[model samples]
Target chain A: MTAAALEAARVWLVVALTLLGLFFSFVSMVGVLRLPDLYSRAHTASQADTLGAGFGLAAVALTVGLAGAGFKSVLLLFFIFVTNPTAAHAIARAAFEEGIVPWTNGDERR
Target chain B: MADADPPPGDGASADGPVDSAETSGPSAEASDADATSGPTTSGPTTSGPTTSGPTATAGAIIVPVEPTSTLRSTIAHVAEAAANDGAPALHLVEIASWRDGDPESDERAAAAERVLERVAAWATADLDDSEAPAAADVEVVTAVIGADDYLFGADDYVRVLAEYAEENAADRVVLDPEYTPVGNTTLLQPLEFALSNTSLSVETAPVDRPTRRERFRTEATTGRFVALFGLSLAFYLLLGDPTYWFDAVTGVATAAVVSITLSRVSLDSTPAIPRTPMRIARGLVYVPVLLYEILKANLVVARVILDPRLPIEPTLNRMRVIVGSGLPLMTLANSITLTPGTLTVRARDSDLYVHSLVPWAREGLFDGSLERWTRFVYYGRRSARLPTPRERDDVAILQGDDATEELPIAAADGGAVGAGDESDGGDETDAAESIDDEVTDR
Candidate 1:
């Protein structure tokens, strides 16, 4: 491929990944607001948000190639992958052990 | 404030009972119950079985039922051990090991029944039937346990008996000395060799493998040292061209040595990665699936949130973990947490507790895609193969109880029928009632 075509392809990949990431990140907030319970809301904040941030970083890495910035982006993705779900699990377990009952259909409101 | 009222969706802090009072201002409770906090704390269930008083043998011991004399001997020894330990309960589990291609007919159930019958027969011959004390040994109450595997074995293939024991909340695990099956003898080792490998995510426990410290100082850490040095060198190379390659290599080598030495001396060291190209490749497949699900999930969630009337129904779901070990179990929990619609609340032993954002989201919660993928990671590619006639049949059962659904239970003798399936009895009873209704209607 020509130099211009290669650059265009890289730019497109960056744009697409970032767009997908941004969309998921914004929708994750919707999940937090719309979902009724603590556990349900956590799904959006942890899963989608982590994936959003991961995709954004991945885009940066792709754009930067093997440069220092790209490597750092990959490292950041690694950290997020490891830590995000772990934090979610910790909070969920604490809530459960604390005697929180899960909400089911027709559950009484507060 | 009334429980009967629909959820207050007008958007002035809908976070809940903790946050409802935060309208005055964001209170400590508000911060604590925020979206990041995760999982609503609402209902309180029956008190934990252990909360009342301290009892040494208050817990239970899980023993997988094998048909051989070894199982009978194991029961006798385990009963003695339990008496010694003060534990009074024994959970006899029959793992009907069936491969994926088996017909969904009652064959697996029959296998389970045969094992349970042998256990019951042995117990009758060995123990006293009276309410009074039977033998000089401590009273061991045997509870038959069941797994809804075979149908779900692809999703619940546990490699170790200890893991199965742990999943059932039975801390004291006692296995038969060896598993000498019929003609072709398969020797099953005791739990000693099996419980060696521990969780990799955290320093949960020490695996049976050699400590990295003892081995690192010699042969194994050499590779890690080299990898670290190479990474450092790569970092430098990426930064810019170096004046002297030799200088950079030597400098990175020194740093790598110090880093490895420090880790070697550190009290808590991370687990050594069981790296293989195939495993990495399998893990990589999960990433795209996750990302794609994130895309679909975001769209679905966004639609739900953006709905005019704010239609939402939150629910909790539970399922037994049929997978192996802490690593596979953790992977399943973490994956559920990372999924957009379901957040895993608790993964105690083998039971996974999750909260789903909507009722539709909870549809295949117990027996679905996530489970198949989890089994894949735990076992291998074959674990993820499409269901044969039997597995697909389970998917139908999930929808509704058909009048002529399944006759597998009829084949099992009453004594061995409910072996480990305390929960399954209710479902089967429902099927029977549905069948009765059909007969009367006809």
Candidate 2:
């Protein structure tokens, strides 16, 4: 393919990935506030935060085309993907063990 | 006082005249009458005649009457009358009596004096008329005993107080409840038990709350955060290169500072971390000993292999060692297996079950000198003297029996006969005889 066409395809891919990342990021914030309790909120934060932040970082790295920064960004994403869920699970388990019962809608404190 | 109110003439009247048996001095009754009749404004019942009118109109005025006679009936009547009037007063009377001139009596008197002072302070503070003027009256009396005379056993003090309450037409005995004197004399428990069982109410002065400085002193340490940071830094440096070390150090420092600052802000102080230098030293020493034992066992196994006839008598024997920690028990077991002639079949608490290949090795199990040396090496000699084999065996039988029982069953189930199994019946007889000999030796 010609250089101009290749450049156009790369730019389109970056734009598409950025929009996808923005969507996930919005979903993560919404889930954080809207989820019923801490456990569910934790699940949303761990999964959506890791994935959205990872995709956004990847898109930014692709758009900039800086090798070292891209590599570091990927490493950060890997770290978040691995650690976030484990930490969230540990916190939820500890809260459960300590007898923190979840609140239901009807029973919410006014 | 108008006319010296003639002393109630019945000496045997209930409430028995406060013991005048010792000093032949003025009795508590006489002293109380003097104190009450003295124009002092401190009389608990008649603080003011003006206030008494409203209180009397509400109910019969339950004046704290002085003990008049030595009759149980009179005391009961007074108590019942006071209860009916809904006002009761404590009467403090001083009785001077003498027990024998023992120094213990003086000590007890001194202790009782301290208790009385505390009671007096409590009464002054606790019974402020502003709070509950209609409640029972409280009067305090001091009594002195002669050197040759004993008042009553300390155990009877509570009973005496209760009886005094009844005689004074009081619902509760109001004395300083300082229990230190009773505790020092080992009489507090019985006194408290007796008081708890009684119908009349008993109350103690509230303990003062801790001061601000005390709370501050309890909460001013950040040692744990510092130690945790130090540990993490040390671990990072030992395991990582320069960049990793730098990252770890920064992360740990940040965490420590954040934690310490949060604790300060929240007023939640960290607890002191116990120093375990001896335990660290033990772990350091044991790691090397275990390595050496592993090497030595390798040599012994090699030696056993070279001997063609393979003179081996496999037997299970128990060894006792004085070890307090679980780590040492693990060390001992691993050390045994590292040696050629023995393998640790079971270990629990302080007892070890070792299967030995040679009879001499079995003999070594019962040797007290070896056990003592093991103790000296593992635990410092200053800690405790090594226990004898008999003591070891007794402890083992008591605590290690369950672990020991598992060994024979394991051996039976595995059915992996040793090299000596070649001679069949002869080997079995010999093995049995050897075990019998070992038991008799013990």
Instruction: List model 2 lDDT by residue over B97-141, tens digit each.
Output: 223333234654554454334333322222221122322232233
How far residue B213's Cα lies from its native spot in candidate 1, in Å, is: 13
Displacement of the residue B103 alpha carbon in candidate 1, Å: 23
State the displacement of the C-alpha of residue B397, model 1, in Å, after optimal TM-score superposition: 14
DockQ for candidate 2: 0.01
TM-score of chain B of 1: 0.39
Per-residue lDDT of A72 in model 2: 60
Show model 1 residue runs off by greater than 4 Å.
Answer: A1-19, A105-110, B1-275, B385-421, B428-442
lDDT of 1 by residue, B1-442 (tens): 0122233322224344532121224232332321222221111111113232324534556565555434545554554344335443445565554333333226545655555544543332222211112112222233323343332221232344445555644565554554322112233432233334332111111122232223213443455555555556666555545567776776677667655675333312123355333555677787777667655655665667767765655655545555544466667777777766677776544556666665445544534677667667545666666553123333212112332222222322323322123243335445534534543210
- TM-scores of the candidates are 0.48, 0.29
Docking quality class, candidate 1: acceptable
Calculate DockQ per candidate and list them. 0.27, 0.01
